[model samples]
Target: MVKNSGEGISKSVLYLMSAGAGLVVANNYYNQPLLNLIATDFGVSESAVSNLPLLTQLGYAFGLLFIIPLGDKYPRKKMVMIDFVFIIASLLIMALAPNLLVLIISGFFVGFSCVVPQVFVPMAAQLAKPEKRGRAIGVVMSGLLIGILGSRFISGFIGEYFGWRSMYFIAAGIMLIFWVLLKLKLPELQPDFKGSYKALMQSLWGYFKSEPSVRLAAVRGGLGFAGFSAFWTTLVFLMEDNFNYGSGVAGTFGVLGIGGALAASYVGKLSDKMNKNKLITIATLVMLVAWCVFEFSGHSIIGLVIGVILVDMALQSLHISNQNIIFSKNPDARNRINTIYMVGYFIGGAIGTTTGAYAWQIFHWQGVASLGVFYTILILIFHLVFKKSLA
Candidate 1:
């Protein structure tokens, strides 16, 4: 396949990439809503089935570190196609698994192969004109965020009406259709790094050491995500304990967050013209205010809805800004750069999840709110201290 020499990506291709990203990343979250059904089917405790999400998240983090960097060394189209095959295989295994252990293992592979979205994100940035890079990324990321927010709803509906296994079978069939579309419409992206696998891996650390912008972007994005995750991880508990609502009411909050997804592209355009550091500082402050909203309005459903909208929009804005800053530092190393940024981002999310759960056990809603504020404060301090450097 020859490399494309294009000034801008077409809307059709961009839409395809966006939809593909959404579908691929949604695999990681599908099991979240189906855990109970899975537990009953496999004759296991809910506690045991809880490990499915954890193992899948761990697999995703591993893939971000080890597999995503390969995008820099290989044709991404080929790599993505191969990953789709593996994803379909994993989904099939989950559909047909006879035991909990087999289902859990298949869950890991599903998470691991879903790094296909990460691969396409950098490719989108690479293919876009420099002035339009942030908007392009925003469009693609909107799809990714939508996938994360919507997967639970879709899976819950399908699992309730049909069965959990049916959801996997349907997802596998969708991936097969996507595979054919990608083969026909996706442009061939040439590798930028020509090196041994070991050296390619080694270069990741070099990027972290040499690129200060990458470090700052990664830290800022990570802390913001930590705050975001802290709130979401404990949201259901807050709804149940404070308002006596059920999981369905808690799930409706994800729908409210679609406002944030719709705003991502506009935010990306702002990042292109504005001072990214200032935008990040403002975004962090908005997140802080969001936590304040949660703290004061913890008992009100209306308050929770308002807070969800603010926090999600703020988080997505900061995230898009962070990517623009890092991508500007090294165009050729976008894949490696993204790997470094996202690995930190996901690690922060894991920490936030743990911290939120612990806080909920201790101080309930107040503790969770305090933890979220603390993470948001750290993001603000980093942005303030390094504003000049980041600029």
Candidate 2:
């Protein structure tokens, strides 16, 4: 990646980061639309199969806690490439998994190693101009948004046509392409922190304790992500139960999300001028509406389509805006700050996956909608009540 001292990072690198972020972050989401197909293959119940995403989120959260701080201490290009290899290995294992339990165990490693995009995001913040930091993070995060949405579209499509296992095989190949590209194009960056791993982890705890804004952003973002995860995790189940739709149709719904979700960069740029907390409040409200729409959707594809767009946009708005808040607070500590925020964010995701599965089992879509509503209200409270102008 090239950076002009007065200008900032090159356009090529921005594109690379954007695309790469989408592809890498996608590893965590590939199982959503294929949950039913996967469940059928393993002869398991939906609740049991749900462990795939749940454990993956937990793995991602653990990695965010234990590994992401290293972005601040190691040469990042080297670190990111290393993560890619680990992700590839995990994907291959899942593709060839001998049993549901084996696949679920590998899903955890997949989430653990899929932290590459987290590395890219803070790097974008570090390389961009002070005023443009939000835009840069947004650009990278937009790729993440696409990856989050697109992964489902692709995996659902692939799983329908080529078996669920083929999706993992394809995912591994795509990751390989990114690894080679970044190895050649992405630049090596000097580390900001000079501490032992133990010291680094301890420092993060201190930062989390001392930084109230980081706590707000993490909790608020996490809650919104929980809602986001809850909906997506159970979408395939809904389609199957209500419409007899398979992964292909369920995945096609992901395309609906891509349009409004692309607003991440715009939301990011807006954070530069607006109060980020307020944007978060608005996003949470929208998410609440999205769930209301979802609960009433019943068998209507139109309702699902509308709900997907709203939820994706709201999550993107909440996410990029939150990034704008925390990343702007301290440039040097960007990676450490991100670790604190993302750990909470993914933990929320895991909880949502678990809750959504439970609700879908006992109370079906209505239960999932109620759970989503609960998360959105919590997010709203975190932003509105604890509103502070940190950035």
Candidate 3:
């Protein structure tokens, strides 16, 4: 795990990695803002729209268990390149889907293949010095977070202007360009584990048991992400129903939060210098406050926009801090830890999306805000109970 800071990452290499991560990871989010459009187009119920997030998340969970483990046994750069080709094809399938069932199937492939960034995050960590690993991961992850947020706006705009199908075309094009760039710029990294798939899967439990902090950090991240997603999963509905806004107006909110999402680089640097426990504690506090802001911002678009920025800042900052801590624990095994960590995070996210939608159906925006607040408190309690172990 020895790093070479003196060599430093070149701009071309960094762009190759970031762009690859962005385009690949964007697949996870393209469905977010498009849920309403998809639901209407397919003649499905609003409740059914919830399944897209749930199924996509299940796909991500499946990938962490099945697909991502290959990073430990195969050549990652080639794996990523091959996966991008599949991502492009998958988006085409999603765009051309004839029914809701077809779209759900497309969502699965999108989630499964979008894990290329999971490979890149650890790879970036492996490439940097111990002191700079957090910063490296942050920079790469900022690309990822940006893709998640920006794609919402982009997809919404494309869907609004040209058509929802155009959203997929743009995504495919981005992935195609990313494929060419990565193949040209990214250096090969051989996998550390050369065992059979069964052996690799079995070893996951052993790795989990051996790293307590990684486990705590993973759970903490899972809960945090769940709360973070709960607000967003049902946001478009709230916008349309409560605020009386169109998809385009609602999507513009994504741009408002980009500043917070882009600050991960600074947060990563701070994580490198600050006490990990203190950083996480502060982040949770911010999230708690953000949820309260959201709860009180009911019926006001400007108020909700302000809350989104604060919540985005809190969530992204905590994400950077959590990643900094967990990835710091095991360098060679980062891919496995991330696989474990992100699986938990996305499972929580899946649950959030499902539960958030139901909460909205039952109690509307109040229910959605309540879910965020409830999870935020739950995470705080868990962090407190596990404080000794986490430390």
Candidate 4:
């Protein structure tokens, strides 16, 4: 295995990194489809169990702000391996937790450790040739999208048949196997920033202040993701209320979102050759159109499916373009820049989740659709206001 910085990333290495990212990120979402099952097992109300996702996302946001920047100051492989150990431990804790409190805490740690995928993203960007950088990130991000969308399908099935706790046991075992593979095959990357941890974090603020592209990209990504999250979170409600479907049917939407995964790599490659601002404008319009489709679909599965494809494609395209812009500017501080962007991204997701739930409580599916369009409009406004600045 190559251990030096001079070694170029091979296709095999890219595939391995992509797979690793998917596996690690899957930890955060496994609980989503299993929330009801978990609540039943622990004798808690579904409302109470809702805190689990909130806590988990909060932990993920925390890790993005604090743990991800460490990639700039440490060998990324070592950091990732260490994180896998925590991931395994956290999953095991959730598997064995006898009560909701323990499960919540363990879920937080699982989200915290799952930030390993973010580490891999910057590492992939850094290792690729400049011409292939966007493609590389796209491949890894496709894995991430698959994990995010696929976890619901996998966990829902597992929770139904094998039981929810069994899903955690299986996940912990999978993480252990991934940890071994990373140790054996992942290349060692030297620290780009030599500084104290405090200073490392302080530099994040400096990047936020000094890097206009980072700030712009973060806002665009965060808002775009807010719309994406609003749609997905309320989707279950739409399926159950209007279509009279269960969680299993809701889970199938994850399978449908594979359309996004297929498009991600292509979108990344396109971002490499195309003008990013124009790409963002096109993506933003696509997202707005997707919301319009959802607004009019009214109980049509076919319409929902088409809207899902368009929304996921649009969001993933904008995300790759944003990352390409941010990473291209700062070769030495990719991790920190990613931290800023992703922290904003996850925060937006949290806001979207909350907004979707509230909207559903008020106006049902139409409210949710409106919420999504509002967030997408914010993305367009940001793009238009900053187009010259971005140029």
Measured by lDDT, the strongest candidate is 2
Instruction: Provide backbone clash counts, one per model.
Output: 0, 1, 0, 0
- Candidate 4 overall lDDT versus native: 0.85
TM-score of each: 0.91, 0.97, 0.96, 0.95
User: Which 10 residues in a row give candidate 3 its minimum summed lDDT?
Assistant: 1-10
lDDT of 4 by residue, 96-149 (tens): 998999999999888887998898888888888888889999999999988888
Q: Tens digits of per-residue lDDT for model 3 on 1-391? A: 2233346666566656776677677788877777888888888887897798788888988887788878878888888878877888988998898899988989888888788888888888777778887788888888887877787888778777777778887888878876887877787776788788898888889988987776777777777778767777788888788777656666677778888878888888888899877888898888888788888777988778888888788877777777787777755667888888888888888888888889889998888888889888887888788877656
Report residue 91 deviation for candidate 2 (angstroms): 0.7
Kindly indicate the candidate among 2 and 4 with the higher TM-score.
2
Best by TM-score: 2
The Cα local distance difference test for each model comes to 0.83, 0.87, 0.80, 0.85
User: Over the stretch 299-356, how does candidate 1's per-residue lDDT look in tens digits?
Assistant: 7788888888999899999999999888886878889999999888877876776677
Ranking by lDDT: 2, 4, 1, 3
Q: What's every prediction's RMSD, in angstroms?
A: 2.4, 1.6, 1.8, 1.8
Clashing pairs in 4: none
Error of 2 at 162 (Å): 0.8
lDDT tens string, model 2, 1-391?
3322257888799879999989988999999999998889889999999999999999999999988999888889989888888999999999999999999999999999998889888888878887888788888888888888888999999999999999999899999888889988897778878889899889998999889988988898888888888888998999989999899888888788888668888988898778776777788888899989988896788898888999988989888888877887766778899999999999999999999889989999899989998999888876777785453
Pairs of colliding residues, candidate 1: none
